[model samples]
Structure formats: structure tokens, C-alpha cells
Target: MLPDLAAMSSTSFQITATTGAFPLEAGTIFTNTVEVNTTLLGDDPSNNVAETAATVFPLLYIHEIQGSGDSNTMPGAIVNIEAIVVGDFQDNDGDLFDTDLDGFYVQEELADYDNDKSTSEGLFVYAPGATDVAVGDLVCLTGEVGEYSDQTQLTLQGDLKICGHATLPAPVSLTLPVRDISDFERYEGMLVSFPQALVISEYYNYDRYNEVVLAEPFVDERPFQPSAYLDPTTEADAIDDAASLIARSRITLDDARSAQNPPLLRHPNGAPYALDNRFRGGDMVQDATGVLGQGFGIYRLQPTVAATYIEENPRPDASPAVGGSVQVGAFNVLNYFLTLDDGSDICGPNLDMECRGADTPQEFDRQRAKILAALEEIEADVFGLVELENTTGVTPTADLVAGLNDTLGAGTYAHIETGTIGGDAIKVGLIYKASTVTPLGDFVVLDDPAFLDPNNTGVPKNRAALVQTFQDNRSGETFTVVVNHLKSKGSDCGGAPDDDPVQGNCNLTRAMAADYLVDWLSTNPTGTGTGNNLIIGDLNAYDK
Candidate 1:
């Protein structure tokens, strides 16, 4: 129906209306018409009326919302949308409100024939309530278009109908060995599968963040003093390429679980995700399928299935006779402080200052258990441990030894009494199997002459050098076991300070510690002064 233009006296006019609930779903199309001046014909009847055909887009295609131009959201358009479920936040349990993940993601079922790979084909459906949608379901939903948390998503408004079940589109194959977010921009919100197998190089924030760094090869720490050419242009380009390399080649696999420290990481056989230690950096996974996503300042692969990880890198037993008859081993405990982050002040050190290991009691227990399990697998008779609390009492070191020996049999192990050799929050510890070897002489610790002054501290700066002599019973050979924890290149030991090429804070201090170690060892710091010495610990320096 049209209002006569005679009253307004205009040759042209426009009409708008709020239509009834839409009965048609996505992919359905038909034509209709519009007419003018039906009641009376004008003087020129040929120009008095006309009919124009229109085809309804029941739901806007993902490409329409994600414009092919640039990174910008579609301003205002409330329309229906259709996509298949790819990333569901809801686990087997129907609970949804208990997590920070308030939405599931949907990706286009098929790639457009003319797609230029410029825009995302997937969109997150922001559903904070009970959800009827599941993975592999093709759904037609009417929702208000908007961006939440800087991500393009929809808020369901009217109907959410699961039309039917269909086979999901063949996943877009992805490969590693590159590092750019733009490479993934076009594939974002689309079902993507990787070709090369990837190792879970590291857990995202100790497994609580629910993500893993997947790389074609192993992930290594950035060098403290990165080598660069004098040519600024080449250096700048290399730096940029290096920066992009990580994001391009390595994809973060985000777990669908929303809880902190979930216990669901299991092996293919349904056991916990570790022989000891949660998926030791080299644990591998293959051909993962998920919706490529970007959020919270990170790009992620939200897997369609969380527990289907194939262990390409399985745990192996350590080789015996690693060294002499003692089988000595070196380990970086990753700040194995005995402190608990229990709310009460009674628990040792807090996470803020002296605390490094675990925060809560439960976290502490779990962390310690994992560490012990990992150590048990090492099966080392003598362990040179770094990142341990340098406290005088055995509250920290003795507790760890007792725990290890408990699984390894009581009276089997003993920790060296270094007696607070350094002022650093962490230091190296010496623990030996009492049955396999005997502590021959007193252990020696060299605190820096001035406790490490500025200018790379001249001395050790942070942790001190711990040296001991152990007698291997079978071979009857005594070797000097030197455990050293040097100044790390992390934190803010920058130009006002260390002035390192890489962001790893203190390069000079660690260098000075090595020099000091050489000088002191020549003098035989241990009473026995055995030339047969095995010097090991995290010196905070890389050979490459």
C-alpha cells in the first residue's frame, strides 16, 4: 500500500516497515514488487505506476558483516546470519555462566568462490545463556550485529533454528614456518587445519590460560645479545621479519575449557597429559582442526575437540650412566620455592616478592607433585637444581628431597647444606642419592665481592656459585659438582642498567659470574678440589 504523493505533492517517495517474523531461513531467495498510485492514474498513465523486483537476503552473509575492505565493523544492520558451529565454549556439562567465555564461534560452512581472502568468514555468536547449538550444526539465527571486546559477534534476537545436519566444509589447510597475523586474518572464523605436526612448546601461563604454542620445530628463547648487521635498513627488516615469524609460523592452540588449571589434559589413552610435568615442551600434536580466532591481543586456534590431541612426542626414560657411576643430572626447577600463596601470611613467600612456584595451596600441591613426578623420571642420582629458594632452613630444599625420596623410597636422597650462600630470591641446590654417592667435603658458595655492583655487577650480582665434591661409590671417583644460578636476562635490567641487545635483562652480570666461576674453581672451592668437575646449572646464557 502506498500513501498518495498528491498530499505531499512529490514525484518520488520512500517507504519503510517492520515486517512480521521471518519464515524463510538463510539460502532461500524469492522476488517481490512495489507499485505506486494504484487508486488513480495520472494524466500520463504510463509514468503513473511501476513495479520493481527485490530479492531478500534472509540473513546477511559473513562477508557482508566482515567487509572486504579493512578492519572495521559493519555500523548498523540487524539481520539474520547462518554459520556452522566451530568453537563451542559449552563442554559436555551444560554450564555456561561459570566462565569468562560467554560465547561460541561460528564459521561459514563453505568458502566463497570469489573470496579474496581479505575478510573473516567466521563470527562469534555471543550467547551468555543456555545454548541449543552444538558443534557441526548448521543454524539460521537472527541476531543484532555488534562488536564485543573488540571482536565481531552477534547477540541473538529472534529465532535460532537448527535447520539440519550436514557435513562440515573441508578445512582450510594451514602451515607453519611464518609469523604474521595478517596471514591468518582471512582464515579467521573459518575452519582451518594445519598440515605439519606441531610440538606443544609451552603451556599458556602454566596451563591456566588454556593455550599452547604450536610450532613446526621446537621453540627457543630469544638470545640476550641478538646478532644484527650494522646496516640499519637490513637490521630493521630482519627485526620486523623476526617479529612476524612467531605469529606466522606458531599458532596458539586455545583449549575450550574455561576453568583455571583444568585436569582434563589427557593422553590418547585417557591418562593425565604427562608422564610427569604437564606436556613437557616437546609433546607433539597433529592435524588439529578448529576455528582460527583473534582476541585478547592474541591469535588462537580454538580446537573443535579439546581432548583429541595425538601425542607425537611421547615421554621417554632418561638414559642411565649419564655421567660416571653417579649419573648426575642438572635441572631448572622454574622457581621451586616452598612458599604457598595461601591468603594467610603463614604460608612461606607470596607470589609478589619471594614467591615463585605456586600461588594457592592447591596450586602449590599440584605444582610440587608435577615437579616430583618429573624428577622421578629423570632418575638422577645427583641433581644440580636451579631456581630454588636460597633460604637457610631445610623448609624448602629438605621438603622437596623428602617428597622425591618418598616416591623414590625413604632415606634414598639428601640435599646439600649450602646454608644461604646468596642474597638472590633463587639459587642452585645440590641433591645426591645417599646410597649411590657420599658428600666428600664441605660445599662452598662464592657471593660476589661487592654483592655484584652495577655495570653488569662486576661480580655475580644475583645468585651465587655453589660447589661440592661427591664420591661415586662404585667407581670411587670424586668429582666437583658445581651448581650455578646466574643473573637472568629477564626483567628490567635495561640500559639505565645492563644495556643488552635483547630484552633479556642482564647479560653482563651473567658474563661476570662465569668469569668469577672460572677464577674460583681454579682455586678448588671445595675442600676436595677434585679436577674432575661437572659444572652445570642455568647460567642464563645460550650458546646460539
Candidate 2:
């Protein structure tokens, strides 16, 4: 206090104290005050006093705050707790969450665990500012409990003090297809290990989200699209029960970051997620250890250790040959619209519906090339295509046929003309090899309003189902091919039985469409009156 500063010079120091020396009890208020007086004129005495206060609260256990349910028990309540850091992800690098989650994960020491199976002992500390804590470091922090995006977190109210280093808790071993979905709640924010081999089930979001769905090896036991198997027309509770099993059997392996389209994407096996080192669906991962986290309404794992990967599902070089005189194929040419999806509404049959395919001619050409390449590989005598533009002249179906004939010889392929079957922006189409198969009768469409829109509002629920009879020139045998593009589960129909968490949206509409299709085919919709009938196309349902 006796040191005097010269002309605008100042000094910095720290005041330290030990709480044990004062014998203060819990719930007690402790305040420290300091004042400065200078002998200079107009020295701004108003800023001379500085004071700080800290209220002592009993140090609570991590499980006490986490409770036994999905949410924190003591939300908004201030607490002082000590734990060992398990995950040190507090760096400001743009890798985690696109720009740092600005926090780290801490869990109660083994000796301090409450030994409760339901309540979790781990917590995420939301410290935007830097902290010198590392994994295995024993630390004490005072913070208020809060929930962020359905995840429980503690916001630091003061400096986090590292007391000493300690051993990390053993990772909790877990397996997929748990008895119940709530089983994951107890392990949230905790270090968990899956010893069983988990198969990569989906990578639809890997390009943008850098995440893949991991599931059990057996498809029957894992979470799958329900409509693919459970015919909604059947009277069974299996559809509703599938949701529970799906929730328990599925979990996502996140890239430990939330960035979209990351420059470098890596799998949990330390392999780059690229075309060369691809981990396609059906690849196996063993010994996956990670911090179980919940975000974006789904539970994901932020890997803590590299897992072992086995390339079990290798890509096939060619389509397998079938035992049939004339080979048939079905494909969904995802929105092969002749017009661009460019903000103007001039693409559909009436030239008033909005477009939904390539945005430019160059993109269309690339898409067309890919489609033609796939078609060449199939080499089927007849093909059923979906998601084609419903325009009037030179429709997408004819354009595709032209592209095929140009690649093959002229008059190699031909398309059936239905003239925009339905009012939807997209429709189904049929094409056959003119050299292998001949069209026997005129094409027919099932536009029964009773089955599509049971309410009878005159509005079609989905694209009309097309039926055509084709004769194999080699055997001179005729068979009717029913091409269907039923209603998708993407959007709801604004009524009951249409939307189910397990079966997805438009279940009733699709079920009715299927029933009506079966009934209409029984009446021999095609004049060929052939008993041999084959239904093929994008049914938009899973084979559960």
C-alpha cells in the first residue's frame, strides 16, 4: 500500500485467501472490498472502491443435478461441484460445432459416484471463455444448471480451479437394441463403449452433417423405414410397436462437429470419408467408444477413440442376371424435370407448377449422363421410371428414350404415351426395348378418386398408377406390368391415419391406393387379359 506510481504508471497484483482459515459454513456470504486513495487533484475518486461477493452453497453431486429423468432436477439453481474432466473440447478451433462449442465435458470421479443406475453422473460445462483444464484434471467449479437444446449443461459463474489430476472413470459398456429407448438417457453426456459390432446403416446426411447412422448387424432387429414392410392396409399393431424398437436400435455417429460440408470429413475409424476410403452402408465398426450426446432431436456419439472398421458390404460391379426370358427393371429418376427449378413456375403439365430438378442445363446434362450410364448397366428389356416431368410435348419419358436410343442404336427403345397421367408435378413413365419386347395393348391408368382421396374432394393424392401389357418376342408370351408411384411419406395429408410416428406421413392414402390397385388389376385393366401380372416401381414403402 505504500508504493507510489509516477506519471500515469500502474501495477497489477492478486489477493489470495483460503476459505478453510476463516471457518465459514455453507450458506454464508463472504465479501471482499478494496479502496484506493491518491494525493493527486481530480483523480476520479468515484472509481476508487471495488468489491466482490460470493455465496457459499453446499457442493452437490453431479447426479443430484442430472436427476433420474430427461431434464435436470435443479435447473437454474447455482451449485459448486468438483469433478474430473473427461472430454477437453473447449478450443476455439472451427472444427467442433463449426466454431467451437466453447465448453468441455466433466464427470464425477469413481469414488464420488452415487451408484444410481438411472441418474447420470456426467455434465457439460458451458464455459465460453478459455480454461486451463485438461482431461483427467480434477477441477472444482461454481455454476448455474441450465438446459440447452434439450441437453443439460452448467454455466460457469466463476473461475474453474484445477485441484489435481485423477484417473478417468471406466467407460460404461452398452449394446444396441436395448430393452427400451429410455435406457440411453442414463448414459447421456457419459463416456460409453459399444463392444458389439455396429453396421453403418445410413449416410444420407454424411455430405452435409458428417454423420452416419449406426445399427445392429441384422436388418430385422434395427430401426428401418416402416412403410417398406408393414403394409398399412393390414390390421396389426406391429406398425406402432416398430417405433419403440427403432428408437432403441438406432444411434448416430457424429463427426464431433456441427459444421455443414466440412472441408475434411473423417470417420470414427480415423479414415477419411471420401470416395476412395468410403464407408458405405453395411460396413462394420467394432469397439466404438465415445461420449454419448443428444442434439437436433437425436442421440449421437462424439467418438473418443478410433474404432475398427471392416469392409463387409463391397460394391457390386454389375447387376445380377435373373432367370427370366425378358428382364424387367424399376428405377426412381429423382425429379428428372426437363425444366429448371429456378424460381419460376413453368415446368409441370399445365406450365404453372414449380420445377424441382436441375437448376441449369449443365446440371441436367450431368444428371442425364448418370442416368444413361445406370440404364446401360441394368440392360433390362423393360423399365419403369418414376419422378419424370409431366410436361405435354417431348416429355421427360420421350427425352430419356431419345437419350437411350442415341447411346444404343436408333429405334432401340420406345416410351408409352399417357399424356401427363395425373395433376401432380411429377409422374411415372414406362419404356421398353423395341428389339426385345413389343407393346401389346394401349396403356391404361388408374385415376379412381375413391381410393386416392377418400374424402372425394376431386384432388388426386398421388401420381396415377400406369398399367401396360408387353409381349416378349422370344417366347411370344405376354404379361401386364403395373408401374406405380404411390404417395410418399414426406408430407402429411392433414387428417387422421395419414401421419404416424412409426409409419410416417400419408400412410392411409398409400394403403388405399395399394388396395385399389389390386382390385383394379383383378378386373383386367389392360385389354390383354393376361393372368401374368407384375407390379414394379417406386412404391415408396420399406420392406420391413
Candidate 3:
């Protein structure tokens, strides 16, 4: 029978070490030792307590202590121990055995026994009710030391131990905003920051009643510099004022990096202003406060100081009397075609008498009769007709001019033909009285490159503008007349999905032609430099 085992109480323990005995008094931490053991040494009867008593002691170490009450009610001490083997024990298979057997055993001598191995010296005790513990934490345990065959162990009785607090790590810093154009001044020639928002408060009377209110952010700004001036103002004064402001504000870098240039400010109302192109119309100069408000705004300015004095020079006067009163009429005569078989038939071979069929003799007579009557009533000095066709190709347009002049009796009319490549079958024609307004020469044809192909072709193959210089009968003053026919409704040649460009083709073409005419008129001054230039034709473009 086994000796009566002693009952252990819950208490704390102190730990000390000796070569032959367990050094822990009451409470100390317990850790796993003799890591290679396959079974609990104290429970194996084959290697009983008597066998362990004769074995040499193993090394033991205290790691923690445990207790439930005062020191007097201490449970036991927990210590980790390792055994020393004289020779290896053998199994039936002849494999060498190196672990604990069973029963009470003496502790082995302490030595550095492979501390790197986690199962050996590295083993730790986890506290009771605690989730986890780190490598270096000092733990305490309460238990009794016992031994099996070749190993020493601890018998745990009560609660285990733990430390309260945990180790933690340090906290982290955050960056700031930068300055841009909004923080600087905005003005032409001045270093001022560009206007973040250019607001157009009012756009007064543009194109008579059409007004446009507008605003935009200042995308560009520069320093102002001048070269020369024109008649009215000196370039030096303008440059001085501009340079002073520019020096105070930031100077804009030149586009080519060649020189210092002033910024250009475009007004919402179609006016452009810059230090170089400064005139008085739509740009503002700031007061001492650097605020640009209303009043005589600069329209255009030149960079060279010498360019500032350039003025609109006046022209010399000339002769007044002689030419007859000229009346110009623009008519879209629908369709006027001469017959191929008989010259007398106006509507040609297939039309009906009522001007409804493809071409007929009676229809020709009816149209001609009406045209003659209208001509007699208006007594037009010049006529512009559209949609005139001929059988011989060139004959019809000439015939109409001849027929009208003959019918009128006194007026001598001539048809100005536009030399279009394959458009002789039907074309836009001009007829004018030679006696009232002498033709300054021949007709000038305007060419349009936009409608060079069929997909862009429709009512008008391509746009053409006719320019004729005529001597006005009443003033003897020569006047320039321009007749234009622009593009018509059709599919867009631009290959756009909606065909929006072709839908507005006529208007766009007409506007372009008008712009060309304006440019020409500005350059060409006629008849004492005061004669009127009239643009009369079936423009086919709405004014809007």
C-alpha cells in the first residue's frame, strides 16, 4: 500500500535552490520540464516510487507561486525539474528511452539544458482566469513536488498566479495648405493676382436689342510693356502706368519665353483688352485700392509706346453729281426655264400652262408675263435672280436678261454669270441696267471650300458671293454691291450623328460671308471714301 498522501492547502510560496533538495518553500511558479516524457512519471507503477528514490536527482527551477488564503494555508510549491541519465534505458524494440518512468523521484543537477527549445526551459505558466502571458512575465504557482521513474514533477492543488498590467507602445503627428492665384492680385500689366471670377454686370445694347451678360475666371495674367504710340496718345505714358502696376503685381511669363508680356483680358461682351491693345471701350484700370469697376474701359492697346498714338485717319473728299437713280431688287423668281424646242416657250417641254407641270409652253408664257408686269411696276435698276435654267445650258440666263431689257424698252440689262464648273444647267444670276448703273467690270465669284463634295451638297452645291462695282446714277459715286447665296438644309458632311452643323449650315455660311464682306469694306474705301456698300441677295439666312 502507498504511504498516506499529504493534503495541500492554498498559500503563497518562496523559492530557493540547493543541489540535493527542492528549494521552493510554499508557493512558486510551475513550468513544463523533462519535455521528452511520453507519460506522467508519478502515475506509472511499472517504474514505481521505490525505483525513482534510488535514481540520481534532476535539476529543478521555481517560476511562479499560487495561494487562496494566508501564507499558513499554503497549498504547495511548483518547480520545473530535469533528470540526469547515467546510461540510456531501453525498450523492447531496443530504442533508447530518455524520459520519466513513474513515482517519487529526486531532482537532477541544474545545468543549461537546451534553453532554445520551447518545450524545455522556455515553457511558461499561464495564470488562472488570464487569457495569455508573454515570454518574460514572472508567474507564481502553488503545488507539491513529486517524482516518477526517472523524472521529478509537481502536483497542482489550488489557484495559479498572474501580474495585473500589460506593456503598451507610443502615439503618431499630421501636414498644412499652400497659396495660389486667388491670394494674389489680378489685372493686365500689373503683377496683381488674376481674377478668380470675372463678372460682367451688364452688357448694354449689343446688335441693337440683343444683349449678352457674361463672366469668366481669369485664366491668364501678365506684366504690361509698351513700344510706341499713335497720334492721339503717347506710348511712354501708357507704358509707364502699365509698368508701374505690373511691377507691383506678378509679371506673366512670355509665351515664347522671349520677353515680359502683359496678360490679355477678354470681356464677356466681345471686347478684348490687354496692355498692348489698350484703347477706351471695355477694360478697366484700378484706383489706389486695386479694384476694377465701371467707366471708360480700355478697348485695345499696343505694346510699343509708339503704337499708342495711332489714330483713325480721315480721307480727302471728291466729286458729287451725274448717275441716274438706281433701284436694286433681289428676287427668288421660283424657277424660270426656257424651252429646248422653241425659244418662245418659257417653261420648256413638259410643264403645264399653270406653271405646275415639269415643262410647258403656256406655263412659260404665264411666268414671263407676270415677271414683265412686276418689272414694269418696280422699274428696278438692278435685279438679282435665283434658279434660272437653260436648254443650251448658257442660253436661259442670257435670254432672261435680254427679254427683260427688251420689254422695258429703255433700260439696257446684262446678266453677270458666275463661272461655276458644272452648274450651267441652273444657276444664280444677276441682271443690272447699264444706263443707270454702269458695271464697274465683271462679276466677282466667291469660292467656298466647305461644300466640295456631294454629302455636303443639297439646294446649293457650294456657296458663292458676287461682288460688283457700279457707278450710282444719282451721286456719280461708285458703290460696291455684293450678292451672296449660302449653303442650304441637308445632311452634315462632318459625319456628326445629329447633323446639327448642316442644319445650321446656311446661317453659318452667311455669317462667314458677311464677315468677309465687312473685312473687305474696311480695307476698300470708294468714291470720296464715303460711298455706300450694299449687300443685296437672297441670303437664305435668318437674321437671328
Give the candidate number with the greatest lDDT: 2
| Residue-level lDDT for 262 in candidate 1 | 65
Relative to the true structure, candidate 3 reaches a TM of: 0.33
| Least accurate 10 contiguous residues by lDDT in model 1 | 221-230
lDDT of 2 by residue, 314-348 (tens): 89886676678888999999899888788898866
Better of 1 and 3 by lDDT: 1
Clashes of each: 8, 6, 81
Highest-scoring model, TM-score: 2
**lDDT value, candidate 3, whole model:** 0.37
lDDT score of residue 471 within candidate 2: 92
What TM-score does candidate 2 reach?
0.75
